[model samples]
Target: MSSFRRHTCVAFTAAVLVIAHSAAPAMADDIPGKIAEASGILNDALDFSQPPVLPTIEAPRKTDIRASIDRGVAFLLADQNANGSWGSATRTKGLNIFAPVPGAHHAFRTATTSLCISALIELESGGLCQDVAAVAESIDKSEAWLTEHLPNLRRATSDAIYNVWGHGYSIQALVRMHGRHQADAAKQEQIVTLIKSQFDMLTRFESVDGGWGYYDFRYGGNQPTSSSISFVNGALLVAMAEARDIGVEPPKRVVDRAIAALRRQQKPDFSYLYGEYLQYQPMRGINRPGGSLGRTQCCNTALRYWGDLSITDNVAKNWLYRLYVRNGWLDIGRKRPIPHESWMQVAGYFYYFGHYYAALSMDQLPAADRAPYQSMLAKLMLDRQEADGSWWDYPLYDYHQPYGTGFALMTLKRCLPD
Candidate 1:
């Protein structure tokens, strides 16, 4: 192992020992059992089995990627609601995920709209879109809708904190909006104000454990008692960093606590527990490598962006390689309707979300190191586009296609040759 990887392992082992030593004392008779259990958990947490050899991937033609992006943009243009938002609570399935009334749908629409707007902004900025006029119009309409509704967004119920996703994603969109209108000082100021509001919302909804979680089943109080979920923290921190790049600093207390929470859940191999609640059950399928395939990318990127030196270029490349080689683990769960029903408890929605973050993680590497992974990601996305010109991995009311396409578009844009 490299020196950094060795240091990470030693540091994590020491932290675990400190926690154990600080715990309440046990009787002599109980010592053996406790030791055995701790040993088991530690062993599970340190599983570092070598991944299968990397497979060769061919780069797709740039023209092919351009065509795919054009189709995706066209789909978004045709799918926008009359109100200029992207998703609604329509298209119910018999086994739909629980979404409580107007609030959940409100969060969903805001998040979906924000993603669509970000995608359009990225393509327009890169000069990748064939229909620039139409794309600009869609972005303007959606940006107006988001600015109008985002401040009112909140937890759907005390138990449902899905709005955190909306808040995180909206912050990203607002950052893009801030840049897209840089020449318009008035519009940029308005976007800056909106970005600050999102930071406030994240602070308001941060889990008591430190980061954020989608569910608060523990106490359902005003201040959530949810366990900090690893990937949610990854998404939120990344967005906050983007806002910071544009002169909008997030609350330091919130950022520090979130980084701490995420670090606690990370194992020696860098596979994270699904949530802090799963800390003891580190050997569970969902917490293992195959299960962590989608999460490691985002979590690593978030930490790297926040100045975690251990997340080196090699670490980033290793995870990106795993994402491509073992992608079937995630693909099997795609469009299955039920979350975590597939092997390793992999969920369908993680498909595009994972690749999207994988693309972000790829950006952390040297420009010379990004080409192979870019080609690999582009091919994966291109192969999955639906005949309707959109991409979806799960059935999330009417929201899936829009959010999926939005993620896919941004991801593909990253794949374009620099």
Candidate 2:
């Protein structure tokens, strides 16, 4: 019944529509124009720092996707339980904290709720439905349920499972409607105040490098992978963005420190590494003489995603793919995994979603140049497609499906271009 469990996790956050910071409206040949062009490629589920988009570009033709998305939305709405939980989705019936597990009941909370909200938000944002605005009302009901019931099942205090994710979606949903919501300043203030308080508490636990951990935000290492760090970072970034949009200023240091911490994964060649593991300090669960884990798994994973550091360098991109081929994770082209193979599976992200990072990274390449990963992605999608047309274990497979699927679908949307 702690606070972190209360908020929703915003799903489908995507990559940069890189535009220069502008003071005023400018032409397309101007800096704003470049950003305007890039923004068109990105889905507008949520706005990045830039606004304005290109008028037209050939997008991928989705085969039956219109119907697929429509069906998915209808099924979900029809299935929503009377009590507000999706599919009687709640915490699993029993606790098996350790050991690989499977979900018993179809239930969701914190991160799970965020993802549900994300899917609904994305469809609405995409204008997939004739009554696209109804997406807002759906989100409102879901958010109300999460906000009301979080105390019963939320994690107490830790970076990983609860609080940061709670703020992430809560803030994003509110931010999406910030302009409309803020017209009632008093209500907006109350909600913003609630979110900021949680973020403040979560931020306080940040370690020296501005990274967070599942158990302790300040250097409490639970595993030797970048899973929690990157996941939490995404959530925090979303939250930070929401805060800024709402007239509340998040500490610049938060993003600064976050970027710095992320940089820890980088190698000299500009390809990023993964986690941080100090031997004698004995923080996270990683306990080995040399602690053969740092900046490997998560670094490779993020490299495949939209992180600015990984996207800018060709050498880094090649090195990452090479590492991906040679073993799994690559840091400056070095191939390796944590001692425990800890990075093998991160919950909350669908398996195909991992490649979504690769697709985003491939955006830096020409269409011909990007063919390898693109082909790989198409195959992965084919392999994983459920008989039902809806993804079988996507959201259910991970700690939160909304964000993971959102990321993957956006990548698919990008590659397919429609």
Best by TM-score: 1
Question: Which ten contiguous residues of candidate 1 have the minimum total lDDT?
Answer: 1-10
lDDT of 1 by residue, 320-379 (tens): 876775677788778987788766778888899999999999998889988888987998
| Candidate 2 lDDT tens digits, 124-193 | 6666643555556666777677657543333343333344455555565555544445468776676666
Where does candidate 2 stray beyond 4 Å?
1-60, 85-95, 98-108, 130-137, 149-161, 177-191, 217-231, 238-248, 268-274, 278-383, 392-418
Q: Whole-model Cα lDDT per candidate?
A: 0.85, 0.42
Report the Cα RMSD per candidate.
Answer: 11.3, 13.8
For model 1 the local lDDT of residue 137 reads 87
For all predicted structures, in order, the TM-scores are 0.88, 0.56
lDDT of 1: 0.85
Let me know the TM-score candidate 1 reaches against the reference structure: 0.88
